[model samples]
Target: MHLEAFLYGGVSAVLAELASYPIDTCKIRLQVQGQVTDDALTAIKYRGTLHTLMSVCSEEGFFSLYNGFRFAALRQATYGTLRFGIFFSIKRMWNDRGGTDKNLPFLIALGTTAGVTASILTTPIDRMKVLSQSTAQTRKRKIVNTFKKTHSKGGISGLYQGIWPNAKRAAAVNGAEIPCYVFVKDFLTNTLGLEDNMLTQFYCAVTASAVGICISQPFDTAKTRIMQQKTHRTDIRVYEGFFDMCRLTISNEGRRALWKGAFPAWCRNGPWNIVFYLVMERFRKFDQWANQRDHSYF
Candidate 1:
């Protein structure tokens, strides 16, 4: 709960976000391609990770891979600030009511509240990020064309067409996923008597995120699906938007169709989380220094 911890969380979120862009790009393609009957990975064949990058470049264009990266950066900055600073502040305020570190329920509440608040605040930005990344074409590659097309649709709000779906997605992810992360960290540090060193901290951090990720990935898949549908929610099309996408998916492909991109998700989650935890360590240290200096904690 030190200032260093907050700084580390913020730094980690940004660094991890940049590091995870490739996996994210691939994930977007998998979902936007919309072939629920098949494994999303098999949709594209490339040599390796670098090959995937090359393919997206040669096929999708150079700027294709970095689609919505700016939006993602914004979301991470906002989410990280709220999650670490606001959530911790709220948690601490609640903790002042008197409770032992052994209270898993208390910690869960803190993580959930923080995740929910951050997700809601940043959902609009995240929607833009998703739309930008998934604006792929089975036909040709035109970066400017895609941008113009998307921008012309509903402007900024058009890009954020699926914020409601995202809210649902965030609830499961942040409500349960993030809380479980801190819970795991707490268990490892206290009940398990784990040392509070770099390795332990990193493990705890990544483990928390990874677990949260796995739990929330399906919802993420659903969210991406909803956003990339390219029609008004009120449209009478068989699949106008998120809820319609959900209905079509369930009726056509069954319930499991909703989780079409889990494989790529795991691939994305591993590296993304590794980078995230490592970066968070630095942020926490920075937060600590800034807070102590400001408060004269010395």
Candidate 2:
């Protein structure tokens, strides 16, 4: 419910996102590659972060790097708004529900509530982002060229191809992230007696974001893999559910298989989330820009 926290949150996530785009692409690619006789990471040599970007550009095209960028940017901005907007508002409502921040278990509640809300509200947008990003650019099927192909797969339903697992990923991330962040932020402020100002909020938020990403990274691996697959992969049935994804990873590759593109995920999510939250907090407190300003479709 703190204004400073809200503002900082948005900034934190956005900065992190731009920085992590390459890693994000790598993780998405690795996950979608599906069953692995060899670990996707090891096979690729785990060479620095940009291997996926370089590989995609070499194999696909330059535009492939930006395949879903329009959708992703919009999604980030939109969810960023709603998440901070709603999270703070809701935290306000329930603030009265507890005694002190620690006594109230506000962190867990914040995580679950904000996560669920962001998951449900942004579900469609995120689905589109995944759909667009997952589909690589081919000679004939560049981004704009394949717009029809993307929707034509299953009409409207195709966009939400793996909605269930997406929800699980969302729920797990938000459920753990939101609450953990709040609690840690609280702990830092209340226990450590740090000033409940912007600096403190920023530090706490960064820590919370890191923790949340770590908790739900596995689900993220599974979720991205499921979405990034070609619609007609015969051998991809193994990645049907979230839990199924884990088992499939182990069976096909090894326990480390579940960690496909783990490095990029950490790279992409960890810092990006911090920026996202930071920027979001700024938007909420100081500046009053209307959400979704003149930008929707690419």
Candidate 3:
């Protein structure tokens, strides 16, 4: 059962990532936009989501919209697998212990645990994805070359450049998203007496996405800046730490700058969450049907 959940989660997440890669790319570009150079003349290539998409398409071509696609998929595979799989397993255990899935606190705690574990485990891939997507390096570099370059600079530690912020972002996102999703779904099913159908799941996912992005955007921005920083240059260190990054962003770019790529983040996370839940629900139904058929045949 755990294996099935892990496989389904990974496949669903990969599909979600593929469908939402362009939005994600735009978000990263936006987050790292002002950080590339302080000069106002060259600082603002990507003004917003639509502008960034159009600019990248016109200048770098449409395919460039998927610039770190492999790393994105890899991140989803490991991170998503651990998150969904662990959460599912924990929920099953709780249910077995006579605990209800409607327990909001339990759901939030489980989600946070799963999210932090997955984030720490997959930070290297997340870092690679951010660097590959950022505009700091103009040329499109292969993942192998990116890894090699990082390894050469700071050994293995280079691979986890912004792990602290990344993990915190993941914790915030999944903690909010998973609990909100569960709570919403339960409310619709139990209180509103809605059927466990596509519409209910879609609404739940949408609510979760909104909540998750709102809570996680600031940390996401910080993580992107940290990862995109040139680690070799101590003189050019843009952010000393997570708090420092937040302070610098607020002090320099104003408080709203903390949500630099909020629109793009919502664009990416909303559809991604919708696709993930829909696909995972389908997988669950398929598995149940298969098991029933096998048992009847036996």
Candidate 4:
């Protein structure tokens, strides 16, 4: 069961990431916009999601939208596997204990824990993905080359740069999204007497996406800026750390800058969650069917 959950989670995440990659590229570009320097080009290049997508295609070619596709897949395969597997296992344990799966607090705790645990292993992949998407790196680079460059600049520790923000973002995102999804689904099914159908799933996913994006956007911005910063000794580092980044962003760009990429993030996450949850649910059903058939054969 656990292994199946891992497989389903990874596969679902990869599929979702593929579908949402373009929007994600836009989001990252927006998040790190103007953080590279005080130059006007960097500041004004990506005006919005549509503009950013068009600008990237026109300037960097259409395929450039998937700059870090492999790293995104890698992050999903490892991070998504651990996150969903652990969350599923915990939910099953809660069920076995006769605890209601609709317990909001418990679900939030479980999801946050799962997200933080997965971030430890997946932060480097995330770092790579952010750098790949940054406008700072005008040329396309291999993931291995990116890693080597980062290591050469700051040692092994450099690979895990911005991990704190990443972990915090993950925790906030999952804590907001997963529990909200489960809770909303349960509420719709039980309280509202809605069927567990596509409509219900869509509504749940939308709600979860909105909540997750709102909670995670600020940290998401901070993480991207931190990861994409130049680490060379001679290059001026923009912000000292996570808090410093937040302070500087607020001071320079105003508080709204924290949500700079929010719309693009919604564009990425909303459909991604809808697809992920729908696929994951289907996989769960398939797994159960396969298990039942196996038991019958035995």
Model 1 — TM-score against the truth? Answer: 0.76
- TM per prediction: 0.76, 0.75, 0.93, 0.94
CA RMSD of each candidate after superposition? 5.1, 6.3, 3.1, 2.9
* Residue range 1-298, candidate 1, lDDT tens digits: 4454455556677888887787788777766553443343224354344556678898888767877787777778888767766555655555566654456676666766777777777766676677677755444424456456766876876666667677767666666645565566667878788875677766765676667666776678778876665554343242455666777777866676576566666677666766775555555555568667432111
Q: Residues 1-298, candidate 2, lDDT per residue (tens digit)?
A: 4543344545555565666665676677766554562233224432445777787778777767666666666566666555655565566555655444463455466666666666666655676566566546443334444445757775655566667776677767777666666677678877888875667667766676677676777777777766655555354343556787788678767786666676677677666766655554555544434543332100
Scored by Cα lDDT, where does model 2 land? 0.61
Tens digits of per-residue lDDT, candidate 3, 1-298, equal 4577788888999999999999999998888766533332137677789999998898888888888888888888899999998888777667767887678888888888999999999988898898778763467777788889888997777888888998898889988998899889888998989998999999999999999999999999989888888778755645777899988777777899899999999999999999999998888888779777431100
Give candidate 1 misplaced runs (Cα > 4 Å).
1-8, 35-54, 61-63, 137-152, 155-160, 232-243, 289-298
Q: lDDT, candidate 1, residue 250?
A: 76
The global Cα lDDT (0 to 1) of model 3 is: 0.84
Error of 1 at 272 (Å): 2.6
- Using lDDT as the measure, the top candidate is 4
Which candidate do you rate higher for lDDT, 1 or 4?
4
lDDT agreement with native, every candidate: 0.65, 0.61, 0.84, 0.85
Residues 11-40, candidate 4: write the lDDT tens digits: 999999999999999998888776544352
